[model samples]
Target: MDCRVVVEAAVPVYDVSTADEAVRIAISKTGEMLNPDLNYVEISMGSRDCPHCDDELEPAFIAADEGLVALELEMTVFNVERDEHAARIARKEIGKRLKNIPLEVLEIEVLEEEDEEEAEAADEPTETEPDGGSGDEDDVLPEFEELIDE
Candidate 1:
């Protein structure tokens, strides 16, 4: 089974003046840490809301030239036996990259059969002609043959 895991990370950024700047710097730092190996992971700002009024809240908090930004890192874990297993794998993989950063498993969604099929179909290459002609090798233009002959 495949599971889509969303992990919340509290990333620390320094020398930031605004919440937006903190968030941006945090994201860039996180990306730099997880590149080349886990490049498929999607990183985005974490969602926060006021408990009483349910109003949207800023994902970053700044204090004295230091900031802690809330960010969500999502990745799909494939061929797992259970949801818990997938979550553990995701946490371990992400934790190794973002050392010392606090992480919490926010959500784990099991990929449906239809979703898997759709993903597979999208990955499969489609055969098509670039010039809107029939995809047949015998249909090559004679001008192209002249170039090859030369």
Candidate 2:
């Protein structure tokens, strides 16, 4: 099963005023920190979905908050278990690459192709009932009344 993960991170910049500047600095730092051997992983600020049409849109940086820039990283792993681990590895590498800048991982969302059952489950609302047994009956609770007293 193939799994995909989208990691959203907020990196703080002290003197950056514009989103473009912040993105430029982030990309540069990422490039410096990336290992040549792990070039198979794809990292970008943009997504594969098209904004205007059904085509791919150009990558651009967006400011999440004042003095902070948001980054979106898309990566593929072999299994669902490896999604979070891969994101952590990428975060660690980026942090090591930038010593002065402080990077904070905001969220890691795992995206996998879901089957019909999974989709239906996700769409449906589940009703949970509270425990039916009242606490008044102590004898039928499985433990001895004296043991519970102790």
Predicted candidate 1 versus true structure: per-residue lDDT over 121-144, tens digit per residue:
766656664554455656566768
Write model 2 residue lDDT over 85-146, tens digit each, in one string: 75666556555655555444445555555775697765564454134334445556657666
Error of 2 at 23 (Å): 0.9
- Report the number of the highest-TM-score candidate: 1
Q: In angstroms, how far off is 132's CA in candidate 2?
A: 65
Angstrom error at residue 109, model 2: 8.9
